[model samples]
Target: MAARVPGPRPDEERSPLAVVLDVLGADEQRRTRIAWLYYVEGLTQAEIAELLGISRVKVVRDLQICRQTGLVQIQINGRLAPCVALERVLVQRYGLTQAVVVPSPHDPAHLPATLGVAVGAWLSEKIGPGQTLGIGWGRTLHWSVRALRRREIPDLTVVSLLGGIGRGSEINMYETASRVAETLGAQCYYLAAPAYASSASLRDMLLEQAGLREVLERARRADIAVVSVGSLGPESTNRRIGLLDEEELPGLEAAGAVGDLLCTFLDAAGHPVDHPLNRRAVGLPVEDLRRVPTSVLASGGPEKVPIVKAALIGGYVNTLITDERTAEALAAG
Candidate 1:
């Protein structure tokens, strides 16, 4: 009579796979047991063979079979696992519908591309036939075009939430909207004016124009809105693009402004600052952004943490896509 091999000790830690293996067929159980002992338990192949009452050659062949038949799988526990955990915490903490936390790139310069691909993949999944997407423009959004999958969705429309810049660049609002629409093979709508009007009266005039009003209305009614926050620091895109004047920075800061969403400055507590630029900017109101069914905020980096938090606090973003480091900072705050 053969000696019965002992099963796992009662005090031993069992992986989920170990628990499920009890119900497998005898032959399958043997194969998986050998695999478990060799791979998970860190037993030498000779020890596994000896413990399972199998020859060393049989142990090797069974381990091979486990791999071939999908019984053995390997997953590295790394940054991705922490990222998933962060995603869960962010959703619960911020009352968000969803949160996507990506692993930070090794090179800080690659951050935009990292975030861009994530947003691109998310948009590909969310946007569909007959859907209207409203979008804000920035460097990160410009990079998103590189990863966006081109697909023709019938009746799909893309509305630029902000007006264009006089100085043309790839990251310009006009170019961003046109690129996104072209990539998705969707109809495109532009605001048909500069991002900021020359004067408050001119802004009002542009808002009342038949064509511009039509686009703004389309933006207000969009099924989804994707936007990014801008810091009030010296490196702010708004300043570089001439949307804001250097002399106005001190006044905005004195008014408690920390960042801007769609060119509307917001304070630490997420209220709009009492600044002339907010009134003069040509775009969808931050309040209107909240009304969109799905408003996605995509931005990252240490510099963006404050603004991102303000946006989250203001209820401007229901969905967030950001890097692991930024997610950690937000969670810590």
Candidate 2:
């Protein structure tokens, strides 16, 4: 018999970390640019080659040289501000890896758009060339995609974490991913199925589809994941898109559902509440998502506090993006 496999581990993370550290220590300008172009500017080797008037093979060599030397450094904005202070507290309180707190708007209606700007900019800086990103769809995520600046990130891939909503819903999973991909001139992988299946068997069949399977696997392998929470309100995509039958809403709430992520309902404690819909949902499971290297939970609004707090507490996300009011509210709780 072959060797037995043990439990899951992050042993694979060490190689990339060591390579990046070595790349950042080198003083060579071209090697530095190769790393910067790929990791910081999100350009692929081919694109960098074209821009620098070099061969694609040479571009690959230069990038490897970057890894051999020391070169890449990413700095988040650390200006001392009220929001920054709140971000610090949130990280400390929740054991978060990072937080991006925006100023609260007086008119709470503008909260999503305002926070969207912050998150969009943060994403552009965080994603590297030849990287993968998993994005969940919702109103806030839609706004964030719209706010993102158009730029090239060569070989970048954006994946839809959930399946589609209604046929024409503006914030469907595919729409969010395609919009971002268009902005970055990148690639995309979309699950070509509805958010939920007619039955658990049907959901299983859909997931086994060749194309969708590839997308789901890629989503699980993503280095960065950005997702949003959906409150259990009438305004939610589930209700608005008519995915949830009128009678089902009451049962979900009675089952202690506070909100949802990737169309899978979650309780106030961030555990998936027992519901029939979960078995039929065609989205990435929360457990699989938690294994992603960097998870960014971008959401705001008073209604989302419970779910957001739950997500953070459950270790679903390492980073958070929200407004000051929501931050303070989270702190108070």
Candidate 3:
């Protein structure tokens, strides 16, 4: 199949340079040959010119045409060809609209930052003027804020999908929401309560409050939602940050919990686990995430693969961004 080159529409206004580039890119056969020699064979322009009996200037021009026409595509291939092949399989298997698989970092600890940069660049391009973005919090999301490119999007709104944690951290839901809003110069809304209420009644009462209710409604109606999955293991951010009690871990495991999205623990099947924590949790329901036009789930690591698959099974996320190792694991399963 021919790679589709995304750009301005034919009917849309174009600059002089764009027109000239389009004209230069019209010769498909010549551009393909040049791209093959330069990219696949690793030939320099002068060498390609000599071999093809063409001028060095034409070789350079044809190479430029290759890029402009999408005759040659560049991407990070972790295992040479597996990443691209796995991306297609994932998209088809899970019914996802899109899947991005980045090369895994050498150190396991760097996975969050690696996925963060990718998600940040995605958000920078995905969001536009007058759009509402609903976001969840985690270590990966916190790192994402560091890589977010500032944009002056008019009338953009950011809604925090979960309540804030008392313990201060870069991954705090309120902190992530506020930082993203600040970066995009957008209006911000927060769920003004703890991530987990003392009891189910208190969570219900907090959700009934006018301000908090408004924010939750905005989150549900957001144009885009971005979230990270959390493992139920001891090393999970919830455990590390003290949001979850150590004693509760055993009970959660007994209940068949795999991981969580927005602090709501889910089983391997993507259904909310039958546990007290689910009732006390304060955030958008996983089911409600499906209502959003586009929901992006970004996470990685061996422990998270099962939950990531569950989230897909539950239809909570339409887009997935993960590392190559995690992608391979998910595919194998």
Candidate with top TM-score is 3
lDDT of 3 at 71: 53
- Global Cα lDDT for candidate 2: 0.83
Off by over 4 Å in 3: 1-80
lDDT of 3 by residue, 1-333 (tens): 999999878899888987777776646656788898888999999998898888999989888765534355454435547777889989998999999888899999999978888888788878999899999999898878766777688999999999988877867899999999998999999998999999999999999999998999999899999999899776789889898999998989999999998889999899999999999999998889999999999999998998999999889999999999999998887
Q: Number of clashing residue pairs in every model?
A: 0, 15, 0
User: Each prediction's Cα lDDT score?
Assistant: 0.89, 0.83, 0.88
Q: Which model is ahead, 1 or 2, in terms of TM-score?
A: 1
Model 1 ranges with Cα > 4 A deviation? 1-79
Better of 2 and 3 by lDDT: 3
Report the C-alpha lDDT of model 1 over 1-333, residue by residue, as the tens digit.
999999979898988876776667678988978988888889998998888788999999998787544466443345578999999999988999999998899998888878887888789879999999999999889877766767788999999999888886768998999989998899999998988888889999999999999999999999999999899777777878776788989999999988899988999899999988888899999999999999999999988899999999999989999999999999997
- Lowest summed lDDT over 10 consecutive residues: which window, candidate 1? 68-77
lDDT of 1: 0.89
Candidate 2 lDDT, 1-105, residue by residue in tens: 899988658664557867777776643656767787889789988899888788999878877654323233233466648888899899999989999888788
Give the TM-scores of the predictions, in the order they appear: 0.76, 0.75, 0.76
Q: In what order do the candidates fall by lDDT, top score first?
A: 1, 3, 2
